[model samples]
Target: MPHSGPSASGDVTGAGKLDRDVLKVAAVVVLGSIMAILDTTVVNVALQELTVRFQTSFATIQWVSTGYMLALAAVIPVTGWASDRFGTKRLYLVALSVFLLGSVLAGLSWNIETLIGFRVLQGLGGGMLMPAGMTLLTRAAGPQRVGQVMALLGVPMLLGPIGGPILGGWLVDTVSWRWIFFINVPIGLVALVATTVFLPQDEPERADRFDFPGMLMLSPGLALLLYGVANVPGAGGVSRPEVWLPAGLGAVLVAGFVLRATRIPNPLIDLGLFRDRTFSVAVLAMAFFSVSFFGVMLLFPSYFLLVRGESALSAGLLMAPQGIGAMLTMPVAGKLADRIGPGRVILPGIVAIAAGLALFAGVGAGTAYWQLLAALFVVGLGVGAAMMPIMVAALRTLRHREVARASTATNIIQQMSGAIGSAVMSIILAGVLAAKFGVPTSQGQLAAGAALADPATHDAAAAAAADSFGTAFTWGLVFMVVSAVPAALLLRKAPLRDELVPDVVDVPVGKTVV
Candidate 1:
């Protein structure tokens, strides 16, 4: 893939549209991205089905989602280093193949243990897709169009969480739970082929020494820390040895990793990126948003399934309003962010989210379904408007060389915060159901499933479950509001995107960039 230097291939804005080569790259990356991100929430509605299928406790079955997420958080830190050493195109292709293999293995799993194991294997590959894709797209589009491309790349991010459960629910209900994993095969194969044929090859550059120590510390530390968090529901309290020991050790190790990052010339996560005010504030907003957004999104389906006693398919269907709302706003927000600063766009979005969450914070069994759906629509609008704009703020200001590392750092931050958010929400929901009300979720889930189908005991159980979720949602709302502080700091005007691009030329179709 030779690109001629005379054409200065980097600046594609003059054409007012993406070049054929850049379009091919975008297509390949978006395909891979859909599979990876969809898997994140695809299993949420299936958690109860899995519990019954494997004859396991709810606490254990929950690990199917948690393990995959924890693995994602753990592996993301290393993706940036690998991209610089082995080229993102090669790594992206490998990541897609590995994810496909894990999907096949997971579909074949006979027990919950094997299923969780394979899911983690899937996460190993899924975790790398976003960051590598970001590096690829950012370089290909150059600064002039990075905002538009980033927004395009964000399609999966916006839709995956919404569409995943819808697809997973249909599969779990109409076909079999196993098909959830098997469905990736066709999509993955198409993605693999497209990437191989259309995406330009990139050669490895002279990268800094491998951050071996940072790798060893950060990955294991995050894994252990998330392990503790995910177990808190089962362990009952943080005081338990099962909860504190690993969490404490993991915290200490993470602190050490932070210390080492400052001393090293090239740390695995590149802490120095924090020096940029836009990037730092964007990260902080992302952290708060991820925790609240992912946590509540996790609970939303649960509320439908566990509280309303809806079937998996029904649960997915009930949440469609949120997606519909988002679909209307994402593209507009992206284009707007490129003209005005993301900050102004973000604040109103946060307010809309708060308004929607406020509705759910007081949810009860007697709440009107239409009202709930309306609230979800509002939430969707806010999410569409807010999520990508926040990312725009973070990446729009960076230098070309900084793109890969910054992408890596942001992905790690989002994944880890999301994992924690889900875990913490589970703890709160579980605690409320058991202590505040007298229904332990493990037992209550079975009874709720029955009550919904029978309609006789539905009233009492629904009331209890609704009350529990309302309490938990109130907490989630608080975190969502906190994100406003950081978002308020975003620039109201767009930055000079065209100026940061490096010089390059258009090469023949077979030419490559190194």
Candidate 2:
């Protein structure tokens, strides 16, 4: 049934006027998503404080973040099936409640172990929010309005990294670190209430028998893979058996799952979504882009603190321009993609990102804040322009029934690619430092930073650190440019409703396509 709101004329064709129901649903989903994304980044800034308060080693305290990430990876694959077996509205509420409960428990934790345990619980809920919420929002908006809706949703994600550290630092310094977790309570509760009141109820689809074998293969594969990659920077490189063992095993399992999924009648995730040219190419582009984007996010803070001797707060403040630039461009990019096509916008966006990274490569330790800010802002603008448009392009080619699988696949690719990118950049940085300082990889960062601070060694340290960072930034630049290869393959125009027809499923004689 069409929503109750009266349709009116607007700029976009199929989405001539915004639907009231779509807006309401988008608001609820965006609220929940913002909470989840912010929590992911926010905790990083509090790790040191947590270690001091708990009187624990960095390794133990690290579990607070690591455990959450692993749990998120483990749970993400099952969400597509879960949403199908249950229903979107029900699943969304349950996920929100789970996260809220975890937040409360985490804030109340008396020990590091308990805190880590609660973080896992939080991740279980968070892992479901993105894909499931995407499914709900995309279905409601339809392909035509997906561009606009995705732009609206991208706001929190773009801001999360920028806002997380600043908020987390302030809370840790002024209030208690517990407030970092506690802050989610009000936001989550409001989202739950809004979702219950504004979102329409969705009927559960016919549930397929759960694919136990596929789950075993895919879940552990992703968890192990992400765990391995996430440990790269701290592990000093992928050379350690600790890093490569799980990664290898995870790759084998993932391969097994892919092979099995292709043969099975009802797989946990539908691999067939890749058959669409637009969907496949967009996924490829996003994955490649993520490697550059997430890598730079890691590199920027370290460059400011270790290279330039800036405080955590100062570094966070410096990063704001990127977020500001993204905010300025994303909505406009979305409208343009809806009007013209994603390809046109994505190509330029990719170029802009490369240009920004190139600028970062040329900067010295003494580079002024305004110059660094300009480069970061350009990168952010490219990120904002490209990310949502690519997502919309992928979704635009899918039918309503396929939204869940598409959502799950895209989210998984993005998370995996981001983790890989971060690991790769860290590994590169480590190698560069090792070569430049001629010291043990683990001690290189400390030595380099110390040299920068000690005026006697300032020149040598600055040069070595600058060279190492510049090299890393160059690779990130290269990745962004490489992404444009697939971006060029994107559909030249926004897919029309007629071109996005659902694939016909075989049914009993005389039955219609559902």
Candidate 3:
């Protein structure tokens, strides 16, 4: 890295307040980061509407979400290398620009096929944002301040769930679903300007050999794996030609990549980073948590819209409590992780989230909205406590040079697990509905949607639909419980100083770049 070292002050005043320059960098990152964060949540709210508008089956409509995530998974392996070659600031700007272009194209899309294709374009850009932003924030704040800064940025990343739904719901309700994509234009322009004015400049970090083998192996492997997972329901099982052929081949290729990564010096994701116990455990915990957490996020809006017979806006509004819960806990968790090891903070968060999921698993059509909101609020608190701190723990222990790679690895883990969760949960919900109603999942969903539209059949359909969602939520609950095992394995210790190596000067921001 251009900057990597330890400072004496880092150890002595490890928990010191953030200075102005650091705040400015944080501000720049937050501004750019919000767009990507908001996009996912807002789209989650819109999925129900997208299904109807395109006149597609639920399985096909899912590609709009899954394809974007797979695109993120595919591009992420290159980011650590790209950031070093191109610099985070430059890469961030370019990513934002690409995302804006994708947004415009997506808004103009005529059908589900076109929308899914354009969302892949959106993923190509969104994939780079969090990892690049993480590299920037981690470098700027150094080790001692990592927790607080991560906590700070987590606000939008977390709060966007709340604001995104309200905003998306309103736009989708009153305006057009196209506006959800169009909305990014002005926000992105402002982010581009803020990045130019506020983010500091740095020369290309000393470049390393591009891990072309790792790229070839990992990218295709992830894409195939996720593709297989997404089609599992329609294919009957992994035993079918469509599922087994790709899923089996994908598993083998991914295994090969992991094996080779251990042998190569500068592998695409740097498997050796796992030598640090804190980094390894936190990542493990996060992977499991994300599989559960993101799965729940996907299923939540669908339950409200499908089972409850609510509008997009109503569904979005109903989910706001989870964001409200997250807003309350994230900062405190960040601070606690900095003081004590992440293990303590993360454990409690896992427990809280599990509790919330348990409530959701037992939900019935007649369950009170207030009880559900309370559960969402509890889930929010757990998310605030767990998600960012897990990354903070992984990064805090790594050297500054390794920070970029580490960020890239964690983001890949997150996106892949999230995609898996979405696929798995959707498959589960469809299977449950099919079993309960004795129809194919797509036919089941389409018929249910039609039945839900009519007042005559709505009440009769509600109970069965809610029960299917509850079964899927129960499956998600199991993953949440599994995630806690890793958090429990995390070690506790006082914060250590991560010194900035001498030559890593904070180049002034006045030196701007296109």
Tens digits of per-residue lDDT, candidate 2, 172-269, equal 66788898899999999999999999887877776557677987887678757755765565577799887899988999999999999899877766
Error of 2 at 223 (Å): 3.9
Clashing pairs in 2: none
Higher-ranked by TM-score: 2 or 3: 3
Candidate 1 lDDT over residue span 1-514, tens digit each: 2232211354535335677777878888898889888898788888768867786544456567767887787667666557767877888888898899999999999998899899989998888877677667656765456556767876787788679889989999999999999999999999899988977678876555877788778767876786676567667678999889998888888998999999989887889899877899999999999888888887888887777667899888888899889888887887787677788888889889999999999999778899999999999999989987887788767776676577667777877788777767766776666654445544545555555566676677777778888988998899999999989888555464563346642211111121
TM-score of each: 0.85, 0.77, 0.85
Worst 10 residues of 3 by lDDT: 505-514
lDDT (C-alpha, whole model) for all candidates = 0.77, 0.75, 0.78
Tens-digit per-residue lDDT, 60-124, candidate 3: 66678777887887777666667778788898888888888889999999988789889889988
Query: CA lDDT of 489 in candidate 1?
Result: 83
Q: Between prediction 1 and prediction 3, which has the larger lDDT?
A: 3
TM-score-sorted candidate list, best first: 3, 1, 2
- Return the TM-score for candidate 3, rounded to 2 decimals: 0.85
After superposition of all CA atoms, the RMSD between model 2 and the true structure is 6.2
Which runs of model 2 end up more than 4 angstroms from their true locations? 1-30, 43-77, 87-90, 101-120, 131-162, 172-179, 189-205, 210-212, 226-244, 395-404, 434-439, 449-455, 491-514
